[model samples]
Target: MTVVLLLCIITSQLTVVLSSAGNFWTYKGSLGADHWHLDYPHCGGIRQSPIDLQTRDVVVDQTYLSPLVFSGYDRVSNLFFRLENNGHTVQVGLNDKTMMISGGGLGATFVAEQFHFHWGAVDERGSEHSVNGRHFPMEMHIVHFNKKYGNFSSSVGKVDGLAVLGFFFEIGRFNEHFQEIIDHFGEIQFKNQHININSIPMIDLMPARLTNYYRYHGSLTTPPCFESVTWTIFNETIEIAEEQLVEFRTTIFENDKSDGGVFMDISDDYRPVQCMFRRRLYASHPSLKYDMASPRENGNDGVSNQPTRLLFSMFLVCIWCILPFFSF
Candidate 1:
């Protein structure tokens, strides 16, 4: 009888130890980004994301770059989305439809999966991808998977299998596009709370200029930092009132408040910019001449008038051929 009781006690102890070892990740402390690589190997990969987009360092290859094409971003005819507070951020899952992206220089078509945001406690900094090391109030990422790969799960770990569109938002005019989302925040204040929303025009959530953007090859900012994504960041920014931005902070990072775990705020939940590793950053618009001595703000008038060296050489050859023919 004594031996049987001891065996039962040992089994219970081992079960508790194994269960605690598989705890999910959080934004701070033990399970934070710094230690994510310990459990998820890809988190320490070479080509990570949320990189700084230095205007001068980026190569302006307008020849290969093209305007981003969206098929059914409006989705007026569909009521297919559910909002969820997934501990890290507020995510909106979309139902499969005509909503997809094909162009914008993407080699293949990618269907929308979901969208989420990264924000800060204060307006000084929040965005993941910074322009010239400047952070915005918040950032939105629309995630998509290459249709060639079938679904998001199968597309992971493959090259060019994902496309993520990023947009920066600053405090300005009230964004009517975000009102519906803000009003529903109360229902999802805790983690894992999800509710269906009648309608959402996903395109309206993006910046006005879809053609003017930056592109690069990088990994997902969150674990397991899979390096299968093609990133598209718009030069134009969207706007949201300060009041609406604050509502995002109310969401908790803890899965359950009654579990006696420390409560962490979801603000400043963005990852820091990773190393570029000499990777080529391409822009769709004309190149901006680098002053080197003085950095200039990349305002609306930043496009260069000077033609590319390759284009100029081709023009010269055409002129020479025409001159020789006329002389003969």
Candidate 2:
């Protein structure tokens, strides 16, 4: 089967529309972040996301933390994906069974549903979550739904229903793998436009170091801003070329240029940092105190079941090799 056909079948089973109420929400003017709560109550909730993560304030709790783990994230063969320009953000949907995460401070297994990004008009500020009030050029959110809560839509309304792995991006060397997604941005320049890509090395998008991270409870950055997320922010940042950053900021939000509607630039899709109520942030690594030691270098034994990963990989490889021989 073709990649598009496969993606259609997969999306039919896992797609979810997360738009807000009747009124539309943008990042500026009246319908901006300051007024989102007027339409979506959860946007004004106390446990909102995009908070400034202060290193000095965060407590070091090595006992309750685990190394971040990515399961089935290294799919490089016979993989199919769906990319959509949902007006609000550029979202790429993936099959849950193929990419998942467990451990690494997450109490339950979460299935990868989709991943999207939030960038700025320039390189100065774009990241939603900042480190000691320092913002990066852009931020990527790898969103996952708790397996126990069923699908992505169902999980959003319940506490502990979602897990978002956030990574900040700095302008530097070119990321070739990330270009696969960037190259297709033209096709989905308008609202609701979607296309299927052959494959993307999802693991390559993340930084090499996954051991050091911050853990906290928060809500969705967009409305309805459901406070049902377990957030994990990595300490390291991904480097992308300046040209790649330009491609992202140039994406349009209108359905067509021919229409009278203004061609809104999809530059600042990120929400401002919300107030950090009384929530305590936890770090996986040891704090800079006068006593405790850093976590074990190799403690992050990803995916506890080695046999399961091997068996799943073997099964996928076998299927890939014989796929052409059989009719779907």
Top of the candidates by TM-score: 1
- TM-scores of the candidates are 0.80, 0.79
* Model 1 lDDT tens row, 179-226: 888888878877778898866778878877777788999999998888
Q: Can you tell me which runs of candidate 1 are displaced by over 4 Å? A: 1-23, 251-253, 260-263, 287-328
Compared with the true structure, the alpha-carbon lDDT of candidate 2 equals 0.81
State the lDDT of candidate 2 residue by residue for 1-328, as single tens digits: 1343344345324422443457788888767887777778777677889898877657888777878678888876575789989887888888545678998778899998889999989898889998867789999999999998779988988898999999999999999989999899989998888999976768888999888889889999998899999999988899999999999888656345445566887897889887776688888886421212223355753323434566788799999999999986
Tell how far residue 13 is off in model 1, in angstroms: 36
Estimate the Cα RMSD of every predicted model relative to the unseen true structure.
Answer: 17.7, 21.2
Give the per-residue Cα lDDT of candidate 2 at 55. 72
Which RMSD does model 1 reach against the true structure?
A: 17.7
